[model samples]
Target: MLDTAALKEFLQQQLPANLELLKSMVEINSFTTNKDGVSRLGKMTAEAFAPFGFNADFVPSLHPDYGDHLVMTRKGTGTKVIGLISHLDTVFPPEEEIKNNFQWRVAGDKIYGPGTEDIKGGTTMIHLVLTALQKFAPDVFEEITWVILLNSSEEVMSHDFGKLCIERLGADALAALVFEAGARTGNAFSLVTARKGRAVYRISVEGRAAHAGSHHERGANAIVQLSETIQKVAALTDYSKQLTFNVATVTGGTVINRVPHFATAEGELRTFEREIYNCGIEKLLALSGKGSVCSAEDGHPSEVKIEVTQESPPWPRNNGTDRLFSIFSEVSSELGLRVVREERGGISDGNFICHVMPVLDGLGPNGDNGHCSEQSADGSKEQEYIDVTSIIPKAALNTLAILRLAQSA
Candidate 1:
């Protein structure tokens, strides 16, 4: 068994350090597309890991202008490698007026900021856990091999660097733990078992324009056809299988006096099953249809086109792998925490790692309002955020115990 008292002391010491690091990181403003900020954060991360005797390296993405991905590893005696993944990017865009708004406010126990709850807090937790392991259980680190993966982009469908990180780390990992924000209720530590797959698409319609005052009957309206297609696609929702299609954006019409010549609709679909996703796409494509009317004098006819793009693969649930869960639950129980399992419609880097190894996610401080300015740490009656942080050492202890068990297995 791990030494609970020593672990607690180690966590207490590391929490303040993590807080300081997080504040610095937040000040840097590593937005998804900001190459300079991302590269800066990567260098800072490499410097931080150097003191632990780990070799840190940055793998630049295919796009030379974007921020590079980071992979930090400490090789040990075992062949079984476990990975902890987190992202440095925030969803906020650079062009937005509030781009540099990293100012944080403390309302009682709740900390409010842009990236605090979504992931910066989680990143701090990950650093704290590793630092505690390095301090209290140095021998455990020697027994097991592990890596820390920090991606530069995850907000914009992971774009390029996220996928590249998966290709680099997937083959060698025995298991992965994602450090995303925890559940709404602070008392429950959720082991995310499943995530929905996503696909983005754009549908375009073309029709002949005509004078609204005279030749209206000779023209075909593209906007009307596109509207019908949107409704047809929205009808593909299957709640039982957790498949859904949302029509996020639509644009058409130049003026009220003329029939619109073009129209475009953009949307995404999420599903838990692969076949369901395929079927939904087929249904979406079948909705494209040209209108009946056309301008004879101009020799222009109505047309419809559909384009589909695969953004990210769905992360299916692991029905058979209970070893990691058993260990996590055992450790959390030992630390006096209640463990729970959850399924979400969202996607994370864990989706890629889970394909090769057992993965658990949402293991950070509890918070809500993920993508809004009103985002605040969940400080309900339970005081879950602080409680979760207080048990950081115990979670780190659990992680070490699991790593030791995997090394032997």
Candidate 2:
């Protein structure tokens, strides 16, 4: 049994301290592409955790072009290990208008700022929890080893850095807790039991160009062929199996008066099941045909080409194994909160970890409008958000308690 009350009080005192750190981090604009900014934030995080006896290091990812990731650990007396994962990157491009606009204002108990709620808030919560454990529950900390993983490129599908983090840390991890922004107020913390797989693709069509009025029968229309291909791709979606295909963009027409010689469409497919994904891909690739001819160009014929890229694998729920879920639910209930378990259609770093261990995500402070201009500008709806500065310490204490239990077992 963990001392929930003592942990709560310790967190209440440390919230202010964590808030100050979060404010500084928010001001630093650590967008995934901003290498300097990301490195600075990583160093700052490492420095903050040093006093708590954590062996913290800023690990530059193996990806040559991505920003730095932070890996921090506190070794316990026992060998059973637990890992906490979060991303330092927010979903904002460098050229965006709101870049570096890190103004935080409190309106009726809610804090608003770039990266405040989406993830910086969650990171702050992790910090407070770990710090509190070091101060108030040294015995518990000494009994179990814990690792904190903060990646730099989670916003852009986490690319190479995410894979490196998982491959390195997933081998021995008992379970992973992903501190993505969580839900507000209700005991409803999503366990992230499952996630959909993603596949991005670029499709191009080639055809002969000709003047619409002069050589109407001499050119093949790439646009027409591409449109037919798009429909075929969309038709592959199987709603019953949660498979979906979307053609997000199309480009390549020189002028309206001329028959299109080339066109390209970019999109993605998402599915919860591997078979569904494979089936959809096969169908998408099999689509063929030069639909119609705007002109009769004897020398050139229309052609369609597609390139497929796998974004992330599916994270399936272990319906049979519920040790982590059960412990987390019980702990949240004891803390006077409702624990909600749900599946998300989207993907996260959890997908990578799920390949190796049972991962529970959506544990950070809750917010909406992720990856949008409004969310990026104001940090989601402040009023409806939970202050991790208060909630996370309790969650962390509960996690420590769970670690203690695992060690004893």
Model 1 residue runs over 4 Å out of place are 93-102, 170-172, 184-186, 289-301, 319-322, 374-401, 404-408
lDDT of 2 by residue, 1-409 (tens): 5577777766677677777998887777777778888888888888877876679767777666677787888887876677878888876555552543335656555666667766887787777666766676677677767788898888777656556666656566676777787654454555566778888988889988888889867888888888888888888888888999989998988989998889999999988776777787778877655445444546456888887965687777774225677777766667776666677888888876676676777767666545543433464432223354336534563455455545544
lDDT for each residue of candidate 1 in 289-376, tens digit (9 for 90 to 100): 6654456666566787877866677777664235666677777767667667787888988765566677778776766667664323
At residue 391, candidate 2 shows an lDDT of 61
Per-candidate TM vs. native?
Answer: 0.88, 0.88
Model 2 residue runs over 4 Å out of place are 93-102, 288-300, 319-321, 372-401
| Poorest lDDT segment (10 consecutive residues) of candidate 1 | 379-388
Cα deviation in Å at residue 351, candidate 2?
Answer: 0.9
State which candidate has the highest lDDT.
Answer: 2
